[model samples]
Target: MVTGVEAPLAVTRVGVVGLGLIGGSVARTLVAAGVDVVATDPDGATRAQAWDAGVRTVGSAAEVLVERPDVLVLAPPLAALPAVLAELAAELPRLVADGGPLPVLTDVGSVKAPVRAAARVAGLEDRYVGAHPMAGTEESGFAASRDDLLPGCTWAVTVAPTTAAGDLLRVLALIAGPLRGVARVVEDATHDAAVALVSHVPHVLATELLNLTTAAPARALALGLAAGSFRDGTRVARTDPRRTQAMVAGNADAVVGALRDATRHLDALADALEGGDDAAVTAFFDAADPVRAALAEAAAGDASPRTETVALGEPGWRERLVSLGAAGAVVARTGRDAITLAVPPPSPK
Candidate 1:
């Protein structure tokens, strides 16, 4: 009974575990969509906030499960998924009726393979579908969540090998229903590898760049003088290190594989420079420029240039960035905690 676009599943009540950014956003979205959402977070303040926002609040994930919600959305960080899934696996049978259908389970963990593997080990693979909404700012927690976060994003939905068809439909309905995201059904391993290349490795590179730059000289001045390009390239570095470390650890093989490939490309550029082969350097840029453009286009579905966010760390940072516009920086947002600046790739020539 997989109805097109209308979302075939009847998800009247949702129990969301871990009211972090993704979890909170999902909860808010579902509530706005007229679904009753019961959410749990370990933080008392967060629980109070969810209650304020008209969501039923519980103190623990186990308590959320006790409600026996129609669907359970686990939105914890990658490091927490295994234990969370294990807890859900143990609690479901005791709380749910013996012959009742298992509660549909889904997660917003970025890395999919490890989660799917954990679910399989817990014997909950048929009930779980892995989802990663490619959205969010460097900010974390429930306070930073937004209902509009997922709409324009490409959400990766992964199906485990043992996933039941109905279970997959229920997950799909959840993604399309309240999230309003483009549900791209990707294989679990492929999704992991894809994100490793596009996300995990890039975060590692951004962190490395920030570390190298700040560790050198006049750290404050260096950061203060950072242009739009520097800000755009290193934005991801501001994310919580614990979460990034969890992602890197969970998808170590894929991230390492991507890093090796990046190294090969960098080594080629270094070789070209050492040999003073201007043409070879030009060739490299020529190959890369269009690929970057294509990637941007594919992600955003826009012919317009891409913008990147930079934190306005100080009162005078706006004046500093606006000054760069006279020198080619395309600043977008002016008053937000962070500002968006259009940063196109360098010209190949």
Candidate 2:
């Protein structure tokens, strides 16, 4: 049985399909936790990397399922999830028909509604869980994988309506135990909406910012004048285009809504400045000051292993918590009216 998380069963072998940044890290972390990991990647370099790291390598995701690991983590790109789940759905019952145990399957995808829907359509709803790790650098591929990548990160887990409690707890055990991440359960649609605003839209905005400056006649001059602020804002523009496109496409409505809201805010700021409304301008910048402080305060709390819950309200709490560097502060669950944040406790001296 898993210890701290109190899972009903022990997970000794984990199968990881796809050895990109998230998958590679899962392989590395499971190995470090003394769990045998069987992984597959189409890329020879990534398969070799996993083999070198002591994880058993396989040729394809189908092979990983044939092995029937205790748990299988699907870590492929967002666009690839549907087909993969369908394949797994077909493969799983065959594996279990022979009286062999069926492994619990989970995916580390950014958007959830599409994946969950795919799983439902494939008749794999009970065995599948949707998860997103709110962690990663601006880098991709196996070379960027690190065991420490997930520590203190919020691993958002979304359980479909038909998911079994045992399956849910097992995923939680894996996330909280080996990964050293805080596991929080959220619904599928809520997960999609939350990520669209915070991650997907920001990535699109960064790409647009880069495009705006580069397409201008003064491009060379504009780039030369760019400073830390500009570089920081445009950092995610470096993300893999295919992956970003998949995210945008999967959550198109939410992305468009977020972008519209952002446009309105920008217009309000412009109107305030153009009209020479000193009070309005001051209020605009001043409103963001608390968010910055909230972030700093949250960051200071991450040195410890405790958690604090904050009821998400009125739009600025996420900015404050994220700014504080408390990666543990995440949307644990969302209700009709508000979200519940799992804030990490302050560190000890």
The estimated TM-scores of all candidates read 0.78, 0.80
Cα lDDT for residue 217, candidate 1:
77
Q: Model 1: runs farther than 4 Å from truth? A: 1-4, 95-97, 217-225, 293-349
Which window of 10 residues has the lowest lDDT sum in candidate 1? 327-336
The positional error of residue 242 in candidate 2, measured at the CA in angstroms, is: 3.9
Could you give me the TM-score of model 2 versus the true structure? 0.80
Residues 1-349, model 1: lDDT tens digits: 0112445557788889888888999998888889888888878999999889877898788888777777899887666777887888878788656556557888888888888788888878878877888886477889888787876566776764465556656665676666666555556777788888888998999989889896877988888889998899988887688877877888999998989988898899999999999998988788777667666665764345565554545554434443433223333332324444555445333
State the C-alpha lDDT per candidate: 0.73, 0.75
Where's the lowest-lDDT run of ten residues in candidate 2? 1-10
- Model 1 clash tally? 0
Candidate 2 per-residue lDDT, tens place, 38-111, comes to: 89987888898889988899998888999888789999876677788777877776777789668888988888
Q: In the order shown, what is each candidate's alpha-carbon RMSD?
A: 13.4, 7.3
